[model samples]
Target: MENGSDIDLLVARRLQALRTRSGMTLNALAERTGLSAPYLSRLEKGERQPSVGTLLQLARVYGVSVGELVEGRPGGDYHLLRAADATAHQGRDGRYTVLSGPRAAVSVMRVELPPGSRSEEARHAGEEWLHVLSGRAGFVLDGEPVVLEEGDAVHFDSGRPHSLANEGDGTVTVLIVSTAAPTPASHPMPPASREATPVTAARRPAARDR
Candidate 1:
């Protein structure tokens, strides 16, 4: 069995490599990930193990799977992530923990939202499914308000603008799964005023959806 310290060292080295490749400073990454510079510094030094939420944020930012970041390879089909080894992030309202392998067809996360708190709306490429684990969750999809209680779930296209919030006077926990699609490419064509045909929605999965 791998010890926590060894795992932390592996992740530390990989995190540094990814940051260098992306040309992102510690401060820059901290700002983007909502982590403190000091905390990030300690992580890079192999003094801490990042939370599942932190790993998800980093994977989203770097376009790599958590497996790749932590294992130095696209993990083979079978891999196990123990709860003790899972990465995590705690905020004033709640916490987030990633449960799926990085860069998989589907990414999974456990999210906690505090009462009266809402998440930042993200419009990107892919499809998302969310299951409310506990409490009341308020979802706004393309300007339509949808409320979900415990045991309820919702699925939607990622292109539509969406955000989630906690509706009840308590914390809400949800399991969120995102399936990625490739973004359509833009091409410039020669001027032809003839009636243009509307392009059909194309589906391709890529890493930029987060």
Candidate 2:
């Protein structure tokens, strides 16, 4: 039978494994869980035990239950997610915070781009949608550039080259959701419109973004 120390070790190992599998560094996990990096480091090393609140917060950030955190077993289908629990990171020209889902499959992220920042053109295998929550953004799709304002939404094939830039004076925030697996290409690209149609509402906010 496992002793109390062994259980602690198992919990630590599971937490560390989850963080690594999620492609998060200690600093990244700290940013997501709102915990100090040093404290997380100690927790991972089994040198310290986290409070119940801290454990619950970490579990939420990892998309797992508190039982999973302690028992080293997969929890139920229910996932506890919160917007404040996302992992934030600084990219080349902007800052991004993951809102929900997993990077390994379908993922959703909240992105903030400062004025004058431009993202490089790139292509992925999946499909993606971007909704402007605040400010305005300049998006380039298939060599064409268009300005998107608050409430504007765009959906496209990720296989095509695309980029995003912030031309407005203030910061721009967008909710971007994508699937890692490739999807069949059906409709062609549509003209850029100032307003997002109501049909796009079918893609509701992820559990965490709210």
Candidate 3:
């Protein structure tokens, strides 16, 4: 069986690999994980140990099971996502990392804002939901500013002019899910090609000795 130390090493390696595969900078991962850049850097370097809650949060942000995060493999149907596999995009005001789902019909993203980042008023076709996994944030939807805290969830029409901001002293981490099919103008794939692909489960590895 894998010892606790072995599991810790695997988790650390997986975290670094995922972030690198996603092309996420340390700053980007920090933004996505609601952790400071320095802290994230330390974690990646194995200089710091994360709390169980922190590990779980990172797993969710990467759309991976906690077991995958710790074991460097999946425990079931889910796949592990790393900060390295995300496509990072930035606007004039805010930054976001897009973690595309296996299917193109939906997209998951991690968004981060500086203490007061904001976006221009714009609208799109579709619906979006934001779940605040950590920190505090505020959203301006159609001119109304709604504050959100950790564990808070909000859903809104993408066609409405909306913007977000970090309302607290630190950064805000939000898991954004978009339920819009990729459009021809935005995505080149056909509808049939946008469907989710099944991920086969793999056997769990034997635990290593400590």
Candidate 4:
């Protein structure tokens, strides 16, 4: 049974190996993944822990799944994923923990939105389904608001611009299943029309439907 530290080490090694195999330098990877070169270097050298969101970006560039990045291989059955071993990532978005296996076609994530926190608005390919495990959740899809209580769930096209937030004084926990199409890397990242991540770390004001 691997612990959190062990998982982090494994992922670091995998990141280095994958980047090396792809013949990309840290700078090249930074451009491709929209992460800073220094941060990428730290992640490669085990000086920093990677967020699931960052891993997802890297996976997209490499055309692999997050499970592949974490487990370092493609095929396996009967994976015992312990919560202690799972890595949780914090960002301006929510805390995201990827709970699916490498070969799984979909990503299962446990997302926690702090009372004063919310996920960054996202527009992407594929589909999204989420069930509220605890607390209350507020969702805005393409500017329309939807609220969910415990045991509530919703499925929608992920292509619609959307975001989620905690709607109460307590934290909101949701199980999210998402499917993304991988776009393989052929060269350095193209210029982004806009920044993918927010520059200010301050939590955004949670906007609920009036």
Better of 1 and 2 by TM-score: 1
Positional deviation of residue 98's Cα in model 4 after best superposition, in angstroms: 3.2
Estimate every model's Cα lDDT from 0 to 1.
0.65, 0.62, 0.57, 0.69
Model 1, 1-210: lDDT tens digits are 666566567778888888888888887876665567898887778876565445545665666665566566455666677888776545323567667664545677788887788876654445678888898788877677777777777787654666788989998998888764222112111132223322222222341132
What lDDT is obtained when candidate 1 is compared to the true structure? 0.65
The per-residue C-alpha lDDT of model 2 at residue 35 equals 66
* Tens digits of per-residue lDDT for model 2, 94-201: 666545432234556677888887776655444678898998788877676666767878887654666888878999998887653312222222333434232222
The candidate that wins on lDDT is 4
Best by TM-score: 4
lDDT of 4 by residue, 1-210 (tens): 666667667778888998999898888887776678999988887788665456656776776776777666456775668877776755345666768877535667787888977676665445668788899888877676777777777787665566888989998998887775466675443332332322211121352233
Q: Please state the error at residue 41 of candidate 3 in Å.
A: 35
Return the TM-score for candidate 3, rounded to 2 decimals. 0.47
TM-score of 2: 0.51
lDDT of 1 at 161: 62
Candidate 4 off by > 4 Å: 1-6, 46-49, 77-97, 120-125, 140-146, 156-162, 187-210
TM-score of each: 0.58, 0.51, 0.47, 0.65
Candidate 4 clashing pairs, residues 3+ apart or interchain? none
User: Once superposed on the true structure, which residue ranges of model 1 sit more than 4 Å away at CA?
Assistant: 1-19, 22-61, 66-74, 91-93, 181-210
